[model samples]
Target: MMKLLRLCALLICMSNAWLLQAQTTDSISKIDSLRIKQIIQSGSTGKEDNNRNVLLNAANNTSPRDVNIGLPSSVGGITILENDLPVVYFFWPELPTTTWRQSVGLERTGLLKMNQVALTMGDLGFAVNSYSQTGTKEFKFKSRFTTSHYGWLQGDVNVSGPMSKNGWTYSVGAFLNYDPSTYTLGFARNAEEAKIFRAGITKYFDDDRGKITLNYKYTDSYNLVNYALFNYQTNGQVRELDNFRIGRDSYILSDGAVRFKDVRSGEYYMANLTGNEVTSSSHTINLFGNYKLENDWNFKFSTQFRSSKAARILLPPLSIFSTNAPAQSGNTYTIASTGERYEGNVGTQLAMNTPPTPLTTVQGRFSLEKKVDNHFLTFGLLEQFYRVNQFVSNRSFFYQTAEAQPRLLIGPNTDEYGFYGYNLGSEYHNGIENKLSIYANDEWKVNDRFNLNYGLIFRNHIVNGDYSQTPRTPDFTLQNATFTDINYSWYHIGGSANATYNLTRQFGLMADFQYTEQNRQLEGYSLPEPARTNKIRSPLGAFGIFYNNDFIQLISQATFLTRNDYLSRFNLVNPVNASEAVATTTYYDIQTIGWTTDFVLNPFKGFNLHYLITLQNPVYKNFNFEAFGVNYNYSDNNVLGVSKVLMEIDPSYEYKKWKVWASFRYFSDQFANLTNVLYFAPRWETFGGVSYKLNKNIDLNGRVINFLNQRGASGTVNGAELVTDASLYENRLLTGSYMMPFTVQFSVGINF
Candidate 1:
């Protein structure tokens, strides 16, 4: 409550300051209204041209596969933001619903609307505008329906028009999606669903110097949580079981269910895995305005408030062990349901349930820009506040591993709680965070052939939180616990410099450098002993050359990035005793050296090709930690789940009324463990699509994903973090995620 009052006070102060500044500015001549209108229209389009940033390559123009996660492109070898503040208030443990990306009048790249070039892991300080359209009075209606082969259906409708001739406009959009799992799992099919709605209204001033927009969005969604199991081969490869297809079968049981204890209340509950899925919902509102001030100064401000309840439920595979091995009581395992002896491998899975975490967030940004002779300057302030009430619980179960569908198993002493295995624990966290930053940027055109840009930022971050954990007793019942307060604060100062020099009419050289220092996030506070409050330092440098002409455009860049004081939690098993496991929090460092090349070739009038290639060497450094009184080190090990080589080739041909395109992507081998013992082989994915313009208002499209039927696994292997010797269990079973199999999709769209 105190935090809320403080936030309100801060906002009120800022508002008063803005009013004072606007009222004190001297009278000035009216600006070019037509140019201002053009700028507004361009902002709404969400596209940028002639950007020379190495990270903003043409290959990144495609829409992201999952906006909830982030863009597919990575900066400095980190794909996702460390915190959710830059995107959403919170994210689901399993899969969350898409946010602003699905709204009408929004850009594919969220930064485009803000006139930003790119976002990096160390520099995720940006504000997102919801939906605002201005300029000419126009009306548009668009609707699309899509169906995939694996029982996936999606529909989207968007409408925007002038509500009044006197400069009022409105936009409304709805998105619905239902996706079955990639595999043909009978019970868990169609286990994911999402429904999102967005609405916005804009009022443009008659003088065309200012506009105000108000936007609202609501989202409700749920997703299935399951992965595939594989067998590790002696040759550092993975293979499917005899009866189980790698990408065609699921390990989830038809009658799967979980029993867990609620963290808030000391009550136990049985959650059915079928129709009673955990659902999540969120509501967000945004108010934004921009105006042309005196003396050619432009002012922009936006504020967003959101409230959400995020829920998570998943059955994740933990570890695999031979059922023939002696149990804690020197007895073999048996089927709990059928009372039959089990002789094969058995996999331990965890039933994790995080019931509806309530969260509230408020974000605001204010900026002023002015153009001077040969230089453009911008000053901005960003503030964010969020509070989260979180709770999570985990219960363990045992299943006899099989070629196809696995069967539940139990030992001689099944727990009194009716669990096949023991209960892990339940945890509760109540936290609030506040962040404020002040920044300034300048773009200088030194000459026609040379340009320079730079920015500096200073931030103060504070987190106040309380955490508690309830452990299971000998009888598998949860024990009562009391919360402990945890508070911390950190300061950050970061800067970036970029320069471009034109060598010739069609060629240019560009270079950039960025550095940041800040403390780790609140995720580390839940540990038994809170993680060290160390500052994380990140540095990135890049140099690139580009050539542009009528027929071809090419950019090749090289980058070097290093990050220190990285913290993470890993579940490690004792090498000597497979059953002895512990979750430990550790710190490490990462270094990456990479090269990327992108090409857009239009050799002829009707054909175009977009080719991109990336090569990177990312490694761990000083990665030493202790767990269970044992010391371990993984220094200089290759990072897991990051391929050294990646390539994509996309080509399209456009005829009078028809267009066809195909994309081919390749990924080199990648390690699956920090020890670099287990790895997956190279893989290829192919996609092709054809679109027909039926008329001015209608279009039809069809696409095929994974047309080559590639069957390969991706993602880190569960419970393999401590496996330093691959030969110890060459033929043992492991679990991880797999690539989706071949699928077809068809869509029809109507636009007016």
Candidate 2:
């Protein structure tokens, strides 16, 4: 009884404080409006003028504000003014009190509960939010834990405070979050536990004309499934591929031409229950600064560096055991024992040593902007460098001794190293990539009726790497592929122009054009081909008209695009000639045309509706390529995986303290390859959510993430034809795979 009384008293006090704050806001708003009018009449619009700055600040009530010093709260917190008194705040102070409704913003909706809000006062601000939820999986599989049941408990905290209040203003803040992650995707067998931490400091100098900020973040995550477990634990899928059974307790790749399974593990191969966990750690630092120079010029710069390491403790897949069967024909191989046609390795159960992987990146950007009369100009430079080092080892065995029919050797206690006949050895790779770019843009307003914006960019990329694959002991008939100094460099130039002309306040016309000449880098496949031209020249043009008013908006656009020298991959018997045998790259050209329309309606004060539709046609416009020992024409063919139609509708309503919304997305049938022999059915997905604010500090929400339960293949595999021995191999569309099934989640959050 005493605790209940205390809570009631606290609620009363808060309500009173909020009411006073609201009254104060109204009075201040009126005063500020009058002051703004006076300043405008006086023509005091200089950027360095204090009254102009105050007027600008007042105009952007929706703009993001820096967190309070020493406070971690991100919610609508107490905002202190240098002159005016701070107002008491809540989850949605912007909403009218009589409506008893939170703002329509997604952050205020309990159903989504995707963000945290905070309040701040003066140099001190703090915000906190936390939630716990349960989720069930679509697939029912048994492993370390049943795939059906999952749950997570997570919490976040943020704080900020003034570091110094001298001529140079300074502030510092910290944020932390903890998540016991669950298998919301239904692909991984294990739940992850993660801890994230970040800290930042900001300083203002040059009479508040410039500001600089430095931030650091660290993350530690554990209990992730390793490669082997990921392959064996998921249901009906192995290593992100659909598992197919060819015979009783036997299976061959159903999508591809490959025929074989790891017979050694028997049915339902049990992954190693121990030492199959993956752990990852990352550290990142960023430095950003912005300065306002003389003559209406502004400058901004930012640099970021990150390093990450992941350790995997699992064995590699075993090698396939194929006998020296009679070679029936080209692109065809037979396993002498099983009398089965084979295209790829099929075996399993190897005690391979695991290794740690390392990755690093450095990125930076600098920009300068100037405003002169009715024109805004900007110039920028960007750079990024990335590197990775990895080492992998796996060994498989095949025994065809006089006493035993060529059987794969594997087991929990099998001496794989001692009885290895074909020890598929280790590999090492060191890779690096660097990209740089420079660009300039200008936005010009010729008059009240017309506006134009244009920009051009120049970019360059350099990639170099070293890779080596050790040959299997006793030489397993596979040649060792190694490159000591693989290198590639490419450059590109791109430009774009956009223009808009206003016929009246409610109607306008817009046009856009873009062109580019680019050479794409063939990542990881550094072996150069003399006959391949990896260059592409693309141009796009669009014209559109739009109408906007107090209650409705509509926009329509028609676009035409073309690509020259588009890169395409092919398998050649020879790299130099199509008649020879080797894997190679090829080039082609493509074109596309599309039309899009979007409509938005605000029929009432608290209701909104949006509709969009798109129709497109894309086709290849050139040449031929060889794969699976056959040449095929692709001219005038539909571009692979391009859809012809797309549509979406979203509607929302808000009244009192209730907020509700629903959305739908649709896509037409799409082809899988240029041949147009394979296609996937159309897809439809639906989503909805409802939220209610129970009080100023608490909210409740429910969301239907995928209420329709639509099931269809999400993606296609294009290499099945390359692996087939027959001519005109059709691309494989994975069956039984699907987007997320029907799901509902509910959340309750307490804001402080």
Candidate 3:
């Protein structure tokens, strides 16, 4: 068994280092021992070094490790390694920033509907670090610029080097970004712009034992536009739905026709309105430090402070009425109706000088890590403090078509029903939380033929808070009601355990188990209900086996998850068959089981292929919940937005200076909502691109994304505004994320 293991390791090392012509025997001996150690433990390291190189100008002596051993980098890149008899050479140019990694990966290969346009922007950045005197005094610097066709731009510069001859190192970095194409759900006359600024400074002590960093950032962003309901006559004429009839006789079927109902159905339409401009700003300061202690121990500490202010504005996207139209006009539709619409009144209006929301927070963390022989230990503590205050008023106007009910009028002379008006309200909160965690792991070599790894983490979290809010009343006056104060406290414990064992030279087995609990306090908006604790418990376990060789690898895993006390969103609905909406809370239990298989093949030089498939079954188990004072059952139903099957394939080929690659993804049909009122059909997508390295420091690339341009009904959404009967008063249009059309993009950059 020992001989077999040594042979397998030797074959893998030879194929990766010598077969690729990456390093000669003499050069391989000169390679840093640290680099070789990382490669042997992780199987891959140079690819991750590319991403780490982009984060700052200073190049780390050790390469970063990959999160998932066999997965591709979030941002695509190419790597080349070569070592002569005296010098080692490596180049990895295509690196994605922290932000671009998430956005770009999803745009090109994500399965769900997403804002592809917002995420499709391309970036170009590179850096080089050289160590003189055999890795003693390193000097490095970098520059980057990114832009999109939609009026977005980002640029940054970073530098790092020895500050003095006394063994002190320093790094400086700054960045500026402007984006005028921030997308909004609704239409806007002028697109809102977002601006950001960031700067950081770091100092390293002698012998690389300790380091400190200070960073500052500021951001300003805008919200989306607003929409409203309108009344458009069949003659292509449009008018605002602002006026209502006082009696049944005041409305007629047509112009001069006999009056039968009090309202008209065919006249209602919807239109986008220029929403008020709302801007939010945040300022943050961060200070961090790390120190290495004796006996292979390490210590880390960090603190962060943030201040944020929001514009004095109402959430205009949530209008009084929904986008859906009604089924029946006043007369039970003597005339054919267009469809159901969500219109509460002729028009919805906002009050000026709404209170702005202000927030301040402070966060701190401390951790220590130590390694004693084959055992590793870690402990950490975290603390957070937060404060928030806000006052707001949203005035919705509805001409009283029906007689004014008890205290329905806003004023004595006013004959309007503010059915959707959220009267003067305020929220004040002061919250704090503390958490402590400890973890230990062991890597044991039981024998020449067997290796084992096991670990576990234990954590506790405690939270306390004081919150208050004003109840609603008639006249939309704050003085009419008093503030209601509430206090909350909770504690929770969580843990995880994992184990891995080697069965043979090329075979391995692994198992992992996790248990978590959380106590959350839900904010209250209604008078009867104050903030309440929402307890959640989630437990998960997984078992897997894998076979790895020099040229091919295969892994299969099965996972089971159970959520015992899951909290749902706070739903607002009209339970009394009224036009107003009331809030309610719901909870459920869910269970899921999933199986995943991954395959990687490198049958020949300069060619690679990867395939992954996942089969999952998620359902609402023993789900019984209440909404608007009514109980409902939803046991054994498939979870919304969770597909039964998902698949992906990635293939790439490289020869000489040219590289070509393609990505394919597929998702099975799934339900859009819990009620199963709408469903989405299966979708398949393809993306292909080509890259050419003109030279070591320069490259050009082009991609044709969304090649299939698959388009159809993606999914559906309930009306923005909840009503008594959704079928009678809600719109039924599928409103999930829309697929991006076929697009072509090109990028070129240099690394020196």
- Candidates ranked by TM-score: 1, 3, 2
lDDT of 3 by residue, 287-308 (tens): 5656776545676655555555
lDDT of 2 by residue, 1-752 (tens): 35323433543354345334433533453200000011110111111111111111110111222221111122233232110111111121111110111111111111100000100110112112111110111211111101111243334433344555543222222222222222221233223444555556666654556656656656655432211111211121222333321111111111101111121111112122222224446665655656776555776666556555543322222222222323212333334335455443323323332233455556666677887888887787766665554323222322211111122322222242213322233223456666677778777777877877677777787766655433333323223343455477888777767677788877888776766665543232322332233656666677888787778777787877777765543322221221122334566776777777777789999998887677877777775876556776778876654567766688989999999988777667655434555455677757788989888767777766457765344333222222222222222112222343454556565543
C-alpha lDDT of candidate 1 relative to the true structure = 0.62
Worst 10 residues of 3 by lDDT: 31-40
Residue 299, candidate 1: alpha-carbon lDDT: 70
- Runs of candidate 2 exceeding 4 Å displacement: 1-156, 164-195, 220-280, 310-356, 390-431, 467-484, 487-489, 522-533, 564-589, 621-624, 717-736, 749-752
- lDDT (CA) per prediction: 0.62, 0.42, 0.40
Clashing pairs in 1: none
For model 2 the local lDDT of residue 429 reads 44
lDDT of 1 by residue, 530-630 (tens): 55677777676778887778998777778777778776656665666656555566788877787777778999999998877777787788999887787
lDDT winner among the candidates?
A: 1
**Candidate 1, residue 101: lDDT:** 34
